[model samples]
Target: MSILIDSAVVLKSYNNNIVSVTINEEERILFAKGIGFGKKFGDKIEKGTEVEKIFILEDEDNLRNFKQVIENVDENFLILCETMISYIENELKEDLDERIHVALVDHLNFAVQRLSNNEEIENPFLMEIKALYEKEYTLAEKVAETLQYEKGVNIPVGEIGFIALHIHSARNCGKLSNTLKSTHLINSIVEYVEKQIEVQIDKTSLDYARFVTHLRFAIKRILSDISIKNDFIKEIKSKYKLSYKIASGVSKILIEQLQKNVTVDEIAYLAMHIERLRIATIDK
Candidate 1:
């Protein structure tokens, strides 16, 4: 007695605890009792809460498609969602609620648009992105809690999910502009650092990239307040001795050549830091 559903069906919330999902010739409305992590849906749905869910359908074909779609789409959606959540968490620092709401809306709209316009989205990269999108709310909520409960900042699950969706949509549309702000910037920087490390480090690239990402976060935390000063170099070296040299060197080269018009001194410093790390490693 397994319920059948279309994996491709669109899940739409209609303002109440009600959600209307449509797939093929089958459509159904289910009351969202509560949709948060670790919560099970029964006969009712909450008005607006992030939730993990499965749609029930009476059609066998729909069910088969649903299984296939979930299997294919889940991985990419999760990554996309995590990236977006990270972006929003970094940007909407003080205004958690509004940021999350707008981000989620923007993301969903973007996703629908992409599916309509693009062809052959079954590519590995696209798949990864979709996987990210699937876990948008959970990742966001966890990120918010980590940032807030652990670091004393407030970011809600709704806002995080929204941002996650927004980033996913933008990425799908080949638009990096939507992710150029705040936490998104952090995400971008992490990406840049990771890429550089992979390019330079070769065999140990992933490991190095992981290290650099954490290093970036730590640096951001340590230098969150002060105006960028030349001492930035000294601080990084002291804080992250191993990667600092290469990272700083990379940072400087990027700032001078690529980011010439960019004025964020912090970014400049980061570029330089990455460069320095690369150079120091090479010299050794």
Candidate 2:
């Protein structure tokens, strides 16, 4: 697909290879060999003519970092990064967050540069990444495979874990914590509730599904630094005392195990869900 660059004017050139341009008055850095060759400042770059690969920076931090990385990176490597992103999206059948474009490209650029210098970094979270994000890890392996095929560079297995982290971060957008830890914490909370109530949960029931959904979002919110304010905290504490107690226990589990603090509003919602689950268990 030909991505049209509308009203783009070249801002600056670097090493006669890369050009910084403003498209629709939005600053972007374009990477292409000889893209900036013979181009002067304030030159108008015709869309689809000189632009071979384009990268849109989403924020100030991204723009600053991209500028730093592009200086040392090769244009072909940038192209390969774009191709790999396209391949990942097509294979996964999901639209990844735009952050991946900058994050993954920067990571791969540095990784390849390190590999060329025989400096390979180890990933401490390899096993955890494999366990938590199996699908993303598998796709990351394919990314490695593509790198070897296209660039003739054999990236180490450890790099797979790093790439998987990028994939995981992109998938979760703004939440870069360990997802496996969250899953374990959620399971512990659910098991604790079941044990405390001395009731067997029907995993096949809709109530169970709803509870799990609520827990998933709760965990996500906690990880994303988002909070839910409890407007009905007093009413919930008074009406659903038992459920509130159970919810309090859940909050403790979150703090002890995941080091996450549940908000009062989150506790209230959890209490309501627990009450529903308790009633369902009794009916069963």
Candidate 3:
């Protein structure tokens, strides 16, 4: 589906494939397998060209940020980001939000640059990310593998988690802030549990993974207004007194954030998970 541009002058070319061209007074991007090959600034794109995609950035801020990113980042890497986005769309069979171009390319460029310099990348929520976003994580793993084999950059599991989050965000047009809030809320709850129990958790342990996974779903349920009946809430609360106490504190946090009551059943379920975590720590 090619939209004929009345007049297009190439303003910039990226990797002999994508060109930022001025169509009339507006900036329109022309991209295809080889649309920009042998092209230069002031060069006019020919009519009826078999361009694969045209990106019209409607938002001024997004357009400016994207142009800035391309200007400062390496052209070859910018093309790589285009390729990655194409690959992601192919895998998902859906068009992603255009904003991903600015966010993802910049993130990957920084990750690769810093990784080349041996900076330690940490993603404490990697396990939670994998569990919550299973499909996105799989796609991210393939992307990481491609980078390792083709680009010789072995993106760590943590980086893959970040990539998965980006892919998920793009696919659903989800805000990164909301995702970060969920992650932060989960981490805070974990920290609160550890503090209440007075124990330093082994983050690499299965117990920690399970705890995080449960917290992720619990937060999702809370935000989505989903709940389950827990006839055993009172019994569980009585049996796991310490865990119940920690869960009560967690409930307060949830209530403050949500501005509503987190059901007793949900709190009891959290108490059960907390008890399991405490038991595992004591046994270790």
The candidate scoring highest on lDDT is 3
TM-score of 3: 0.57
Give the root-mean-square deviation of each candidate in angstroms. Answer: 16.7, 16.7, 13.3
| lDDT string, candidate 3, 155-269, tens digits | 8999998788778767754456766787688788888888898999876454565576566656765765655557788799779998998998999999998776798888998
TM-score of each: 0.26, 0.55, 0.57
Best by TM-score: 3
Local lDDT at 157 for model 3? 93
Candidate 3 clash pair list: none
lDDT of 2 by residue, 1-284 (tens): 44554757888886566788888888887766677888878998786665555777675645665565566567667667877887888887886766566668877876877887889876644676677789989999999998878767788989997788778666775444554565577778889999988998876454665576567656755765565556678999999999999999998887676577777778898999999999999998
Candidate 3's C-alpha runs over 4 A off are 1-7, 11-18, 24-26, 32-43, 174-284
241 Cα displacement, candidate 2 (Å)? 48
Order the numbered candidates by TM-score, best leading.
3, 2, 1
What are the lDDT figures for the candidates, one per model? 0.41, 0.75, 0.78
What is the alpha-carbon RMSD of candidate 3 to the true structure?
13.3
> Candidate 2 has what TM-score?
0.55
User: Model 1, 224-248: lDDT tens per residue?
Assistant: 3323334355555576554554455
